[model samples]
Target chain A: MNPTTLKLCLMAVLSLVGIGLYGLMICRNLIKMVIVLQILVKAAALGLILAGQMSSQINLGQSLGITVIVADTIVAVVGMALAVQVQRRLGTLDVDALSSLRG
Target chain B: MLEAILFALPILTALLAGIQAIRTRSLIRSALWLAGVSASIAVLFYMLGAHQVAVIELSVGAGLVTVLFVFAIGIAGAEIQPQRPIVPKTLAWVLILVAILLLAGFALPFATTVQHSTEPETTSVFWQQRGLDVIVQVVLIFCGVLGLLGVLAEEKAPLDQPMVDEIAAERERDLRNLEYQSSQSMVSSQQGQTR
Candidate 1:
């Protein structure tokens, strides 16, 4: 990747990270939070790819990036499932209501 | 020229999708936007020559994650009120613009060169150096299934007499409806025979 391309990729990562942080801070919905986490995961993956490209360790970077992607999918699936169950039992998807862990 | 455009395409797509994902109020639409981000990232990976990682991202990110989000939204059955997304949206854009200006002012002066591999094949490293990561990935997926099962496992609800009666009555009505339909079909068949 050229310098411009690299800079663009970095800029993309920063934008995604910023957007994801905004969602995480402002969104009250649990499912949306999980979706925002996915955005953050993509940013991390992109960052890893950029790292690989810069160091010419493409194989190592790709391997790590794939690991990140796998872990992210698992987390998203589990998180969403839990969110669904929370809505079912608590009767609300609001994070404030879920703040208490009283059984 | 083409290389620059190709490199920028996925980045542009991801930035747009990220903004949309953060700003959308509807859970389903937000999930779709996340999928768009994932697909664009996969495109970036492919363009960077990481074919294996790209395929994995395409399958798990774009495919499974989106489906899972939609299913969760379906089950949750909560209407996400359109909150004030403008604040976060504008803040995100402003921060991005600032970061771009800072990068241009500070980082562009060096013009550091990057060295990319000509062969993007990573299967060797995946099995050799990152075997443990793969194992961890499998464990994480298995744990996710277990976690889902744990969450969805419902306790037996105590059945009240009225609730039981209501259920039985509904079942009886359904049975009566089925019987009526079957009898009508049988009678129609006999009429056809007579004809």
Candidate 2:
């Protein structure tokens, strides 16, 4: 990859991270939070690959990216499971309503 | 020129999809948009020469994750009544602006310094050197399955007789009190009619 391409990929990764963080800050829905988290992980995976491309260790980056994907999938699955439970028990998906877990 | 455009296409698509995923009101729609973002990212990965990771991203990120989100939406109800963001809009925008500036500052230095390597053998690196990551990922997947089972498990009624009896008694008492109150109100109304 040329430096220009590398730079563009880096910018995309940064933008994705920013968007993910902004979403995390603003979104109160538990499911939305999970979605934002997935986005953040995607950015990280892309960044890892970009780093690999930069250093010429593309295989290492790909391997790490695969690791990230597996971990991220698990996170998403567990997060959704927790969200379903929260909705069932609390009768609402709003994170604001979960302020006191006293039930 | 052709290479840059090819890279730009997927990057643009990913960014747009990501923004739409955040901006969309419906959870399902947001999930779909996320799928688009993931697909585009996979494309980007393929373009970047990470063929295996790209395939996995397409399957796991775009396919499996989106399916999970839809299933979750089906069970949990799709739309929450829209609420104002926890962060005020002005502050949120300011924060985003600051974040962008910081990211540009951090990322700009690396743009000119990237050096490309000739050998791109992903298979050996994945299988030989990164064995720990693969093992840990397997463990993580198992733990995730266990966690899902734990979270979604049906809550069994307590076997404690005393606690069960106490709860039953409390419910019965509340029912009796409600009945008594209704009866008292009826008698008062009848008495008022006689007057």
Candidate 3:
């Protein structure tokens, strides 16, 4: 990545991280929470790629990025499934309603 | 100038997608915006010379993740309900402004100094150094899929009794109508025979 692109990537990472934090703090819905988390993970992946580029280890960064992508997909799938189950059993999608841990 | 713009396209795309994903009311629309973000990031990956990673990002991030999200939304039966933002509008905008200022302050100094790497082929690195991680990731994906199915497999009663009851009543009415029609047809045949 060029200097401009690197800066852009860093900018993206910062923006996404901020958005993810804000969303996670405020969103009441579980699915939305999962989406926000994905955003955060994406930022981390971008950061890893940027780090790799800076250090002249592009392959290492690419490998790490791949790992991040795989892990994120798994997280998203599991999280969405959990959200579906929560909506099924709890009758609400709101996080407040899911406060019960008895089950 | 064109080179800079070309490189900036994916970043700009990602920014727009993030904004849309955050602001969209419908969960499905949000998921779509997420797809947009993923696709843009894949483009960025490709531009960065990680071709294989870019393909995986496109396939997994843009394709599989979106499908899963859409499926989950379908299962949830969520409406196009507008979510109330956690922060007030003015507050959110103000926060965004602050974030932009901070990002600029942080990134400006490094912008001119970062050098592009002469990257080795990405595939060899994955197989050589990161092989174990790949295997583990594959295992994680398996576990995740199984876990999802396990969660979904557990049967639960319908959350809304009224909707279930309404469906039952509609079915019963249909059955009753069918019976009534059959009985009327039988009686009409007997009358015709007598005539």
Candidate 4:
């Protein structure tokens, strides 16, 4: 990739990270939180690939991206499972309602 | 022009999808929009010459994650009752804009300084060089599976005897109340018939 392309890609990654953080700050729903997390991780993975491309170690970048994908999948699965349990027990998915730790 | 178009298309799609994912009211729609974001990212990855990562992102990030989100929504609930955001919208936007600008300021100079390589190495580095990371990732995946099982497991009653006894007693009282109500209704019907 050219320097200009790299700059553009980096900008996109930053924009994505910003959007994800914004969503995390405002969204109260647990599942929505997970969705935002997924977005954030995707941008990170893109950044990893970009780093690899820049460093002339595209293979290393791709490998790291794959590792990130596997870990992210596990996170989503576990997050969803926990969200289901929270909804079942607390009767609401709002993170604010979870302020009281009482079962 | 074509190269510019290729980069612009995916980036625009990703930005728009991400914004919609956060803004949409329906949880399912939000998840779908997230999938859209993932797909666009995959496109960007492919354009960046990371074809393998792009495929995985399409399959896992766009496909599996979206399915998981939808399934979770199906179980938990689909509609999020509209509520005020935790942070006020104006303040949140200002903070986000400031953060993005700060990050870009820090990142842009470093990005410009890096010279692109003519010869790019591919998957050999992954298989030959990063064995430790692969093993650790495997271990992490196993732990995640175990954690999922633990979270989803049926809750056993508390070990405390008093608490168990109290729950049993409460259930019994509820059953008795239900029986009494049914009997009282039956008695009232009998009296009306007699009249």
lDDT of 3 at B115: 59
| CAPRI class assigned to model 2 | medium
What proportion of the true contacts does each candidate reproduce? Answer: 0.63, 0.75, 0.57, 0.74
DockQ of each: 0.42, 0.58, 0.40, 0.57
CAPRI quality band, candidate 3: acceptable
Q: lDDT tens digits, residues B1-195, model 1?
A: 678788888888888988888787778888898889999999988988778889989998999888878877877863687554434767766765775577556644443677544653477788877789989988998988986774455632357567899999999999999999999999999999999
Highest DockQ: which candidate?
A: 2
Q: What is the DockQ ranking, best to worst? A: 2, 4, 1, 3
lDDT of 4: 0.86
CA lDDT, candidate 4, residue B110: 69
Residue-level lDDT tens digits of model 4 in B116-139:
566435556676687777897898
- Residue-wise lDDT of candidate 3 within A4-101, one digit each (tens)? 66776777778777877777766878888898888889878877777776777878988999899989988888888778888877877888777784
Higher DockQ: candidate 3 or 4?
Answer: 4
What are the per-residue Cα lDDT tens digits for candidate 3 across B48-76? 76677789989989998888898888888
For model 2, the superposed segments whose C-alpha errors exceed 4 Å read: B116-120, B150-152, B155-195
Best by TM-score: 2
TM-score of 2: 0.84
Clashes of 1: 0
Residue B138 accuracy (lDDT) in model 3? 81
Q: What is the interface RMSD of each candidate, in Å?
A: 3.5, 1.9, 2.9, 2.2
